[model samples]
Target: MNAVATSSADVDAIAQVVAAVERAQQAKDAEGFLALFHPDALWTTAHGKVLIGLDAIAEFTRAVLPKDDWDGRVTYEVVHTQFLRPDVAAVKVRQVYHGPDGGSEGAPLYVMTKQDNGAWLLHANQNTPVQTD
Candidate 1:
């Protein structure tokens, strides 16, 4: 079995993982999105709060996609990375979601964790609303 990596490695792995997340979201591949996470992965949304376990995770993700305004595409950049431990890390990514109708929402901060399997997965995520006011 693979082991968790160092902090830097965790960051690198998560970078890719997050990218894959974007791709999966764009593709609306529910299974693909789920595949990036460990069986026991958890995600805490910015406003909706915590979604624990894979079933909830899948439900949340499915709800997001196929929305009347769902873009299914997200573009983002990693603004910061913090490591709480060798196997544990978090990333703040600046993200924007673009739906099929050309609407967009964003700058959400995404936090991720690298599991014992040496794969980085979404741990928690939140975003400040885009200032349009």
Candidate 2:
């Protein structure tokens, strides 16, 4: 971790990126969601499928997101953020999907990087379903 202090501005920016993700997922807009990712991003789905790069992520998103069968909306909330560097952050998110049946939760960790233009983009992410006993 870089010794630099984490700023509220950076946290706010990261939160905005997360909010965009929620919006995209709720709207089933693959392109909108993909726009927030880095070219070499890695993503692991809640079900354990791993996507290696933007191309692979794009392919999967396009194929699966629109066809999702859940008749409800999903929400993503940023629960914590750790700054690894001035330009990189590891964010923990609480994800919930509410449908006619009930609600399912997920714990997603998103590693995001800030670009030269100061824009934060998702670099790597893993979504793990919350198992209830």
Candidate 3:
């Protein structure tokens, strides 16, 4: 998705995209989640496989997420929202997770965007491991 628009409506679109992503994750609806990405969107993780394009993202998710059976619950702390234009916005989100395997985790970044169709979608996402030194 090209993030080069400038308007209040664009900002709203981005927010909707963020909400959709969260909903998809909670529902374990990989299709719904992947549908939000562009045809050729790319994703990089802190570790494990790199997902490029919608198909790859779906495949990667199917391969890894099952190992955890995530509880489909997450809490988001939106640090800030930046509008590079209007359609292009990068929202810094911190997500807290409670894994089903009795393990707790958190994702520190979830970027949101507004696509060319004026619909918001998750263009890229990367969850960072918290450092506790």
Candidate 4:
């Protein structure tokens, strides 16, 4: 975690990527969501399923995302961000699903890397369900 000040431009760019994720999830567009990931990205689902690399991630996402039966609207908010380097950031996100039944939440950590082309892509991410006692 770097204590140095991060550029607002970079922060804004990261926020855009997160927003894209929200849009994709809400639309059930697996391809759109996968577009934000790095080629070698690692992802862990809220249920603890691990997906390594874009290929695996894509396979799992394509299989499940579109077919998801949860009739809920999902929202993603970037809660915090720590710059590991100028091109790497660890972002904490607050995820919530508003459904007919009720609302459920997730805490996701997305480690994103800035590409040479000036795009921030998800590198490693973990989605953990926020259980209520």
Candidate 5:
């Protein structure tokens, strides 16, 4: 996935990984979401809680995800991807929460690493709420 050698397939695969996150969120499937992360992945919540690893992330998400109700839908769009190396990338995402009452958004950064098996797994991620004036 290096910039020089990046192919459409690589970009598509990365987009799919990002889409999977949105799917898991919509379904409130904690396990499904966790499967996308590396064993030592770090995740920071939009509200600023920092989770150090898979275990901590799982614990937090299992409790919070199920309690979430968007009343409409949520979407995740891959806005950009910067390849740090052939096996690593920094992906920027635009996240939107849509509901009848209106919506909110977040800008998330997901740093993904290509696994030995060639799958892209989230290595580190941060969710920052998009504040509107």
Candidate 6:
């Protein structure tokens, strides 16, 4: 436990960071997406590929983003957030991919760290596929 954020403004700021992620993804802008991550960030794909560092994430993203022609769109909604410290938070997101066929869901957890400059950077994240029964 670090420091808990007790301000509604902090919550709003965190929400902005989450929204930025969705915006970048929707535009397929690799640079925009990478800007949100810390240099030593970790990312685990929904398919379970673990990526360490921004470089690895950038490589993987560049390869996949350009090739995505799924004829669908993705939406990311912040479902919950918990502050671990004043500078760190865990955020859960509900992701939905709407395609021509139907829609698929994902649950992603993003661990964010607030910088000295008051910017929240993604430190670690994991995207999990939602299995429907």
Model 2 stretches astray by more than 4 angstroms: 1-3
Candidates in descending lDDT order:
4, 2, 5, 6, 1, 3
Pairs that collide in candidate 2 are none
Off by over 4 Å in 4: none
Local distance difference test scores for all models:
0.69, 0.94, 0.66, 0.95, 0.90, 0.89
lDDT per residue as tens, model 4, 1-133: 4386679999999999999999999999999999999999999999999999999999999999897587539999999999988999999999999987789999999999999999999999999999999
Instruction: List clashing residue pairs in candidate 1.
Output: 71-99, 71-100
For model 3, name the residue pairs that clash. 3-88, 5-86
Q: How would you encode candidate 2's per-residue C-alpha lDDT over 1-133 as one tens digit per residue?
A: 3376878989999999999999999999999999999999999999999999999999999998888586539999999999988999999999999987788999999999999998999999999999998
- Per-structure clash totals for the candidates: 2, 0, 2, 0, 0, 2
List all candidate RMSDs to the true structure.
5.1, 1.5, 4.1, 1.3, 2.0, 1.8
lDDT of 2 at 108: 96
Best by lDDT: 4
Which RMSD does model 1 reach against the true structure?
5.1
Q: Choose 3 or 5, whichever is better by TM-score.
A: 5
Task: Compute each candidate's TM-score over C-alphas.
Answer: 0.73, 0.95, 0.74, 0.95, 0.93, 0.93
Per-residue lDDT of model 3, residues 22-78, tens digit only: 787777777777777776667776574578788888888766654555567765556
Please tell me which model should have the higher TM-score, number 2 or number 4.
Answer: 4
Top-scoring candidate (TM-score)? 4
lDDT of 1 by residue, 9-61 (tens): 66677788878877877887888888876656667664656778888888987
Q: Give the range where candidate 5 is weakest over 10 consecutive residues by summed lDDT.
A: 1-10
Tell me the tens digit of each residue's lDDT in model 5 across 40-130: 9999999899999999999998998887454427999999998888788899999999877688899999999998988999999999999
Candidates 4 and 6: which is better by lDDT? 4
lDDT for model 1, please.
Answer: 0.69
